[model samples]
Target: MPGRSHSGGVIRRLAPLALMPAGAFAVHQLRYWLAFAGRTGLLLQQQGHAYLHSVVPWIVLLAAIAVGVFLQALGRAFGGQCSLPRQTVSFGALWLICAASLVAIYIAQEFLEGLFVTGHPAGLAGIFGYGGWWSIPAAAAVGLVLAVSFHGAHRVLHAVADRRARPAVRVRGPARARAPRHVPAPALAPLADGWSGRGPPR
Candidate 1:
């Protein structure tokens, strides 16, 4: 299992897909908890509305999942040559990518909302000018957390797969063929010539 430690079947590869959304949801909850520590009821209620009211969070989740799947596909095509430095760089790039994508999507959503309310949509700078820049750092922070979660989950899954793939140890020794249970005594032979049943020759 030298080279195959990181490699696995379909299930092992696809298992991490669920972690992407779970990480996103966990971060959202943490944000809610921090923002509304006193109002437990409102905080609990917001969880449902979070996804129902807006498409932004769902879109971000989908985008993250898509990126994860793409990376897994790439890992499969090439081998799982994920060294420590390589994974760090990869996830770091992922953090930047997710942050950029999330910010862009949020801006687009804001633009659409503005266009719906007012006839004209706000210009790009106007969108960023009016307190919209905050989204950048927030998204980047969330993206960083998600990237770390993904990396950790991947390592755990591969470790489990490697353990399961190992060959079982043998306990009993090799079997040997059985010897005959009983042996017959040699038959009595006749005496020298001219001797019958008597002890000595006639």
Candidate 2:
């Protein structure tokens, strides 16, 4: 149906935009899972258990992924029309923006964790204390990965678009074999000697 085909086309166009975000989310979840399984010190504690039991971590994670999707969509909007050097610069800027955004999100997550899990608001001084500087480099690294992911996704989308835009080739079936024409063999050269039925002139 027309509607189905149209929807499929739309999905095809939009799917690549989410690739980077989806990958980011997967990596984030994997890290969390591994940390949880290995009894790592990464998971923070609130009362007597890990703060992950609260809903805030999941909410923050989803929010981060949403931010990622928005960034990827933004890249999709401008990255394709520009030249390679321009794209490189723009994506580099995007990386810096993502790093800054991550830092902000980290601060917010810390604040929210305190408010909901510890029942007190976290002071900015405490949030940006000595160990906080680690966030900057971590976020920068994450952003760089995301920037590369967005570029890869763009390439995939371009390839798909090119493939879809190409004209279709028609393939024909093989030709049928024809029968040979009959020529009657020139009546066998009149029997070579005109042999009569009267016993060959006895």
lDDT of 2 by residue, 1-202 (tens): 9999567446544543443433333333343344355543444332222644464466566556555654554454444431112234477787777667666766676566556655333666434542445556666777677677656655655554455556679988998898988867555554575764455655
RMSD (CA, Å), candidate 2 to true, equals 9.7
Candidate 1: deviation at residue 132, Å? 0.7
What are the lDDT figures for the candidates, one per model? 0.54, 0.52
- Model 2 whole-model lDDT (C-alpha atoms): 0.52
lDDT of 1 by residue, 1-202 (tens): 7547555444345544544544444444444445455673473443233332465567577666656664664454344333322244577787787666656656665566445544323566434543446556666777787677667656654554455556669898889989978888776565544456866558
Show pairs that collide, candidate 1.
none
Candidate 1 vs. true structure, TM-score: 0.44
- Give the clash count for model 2: 0
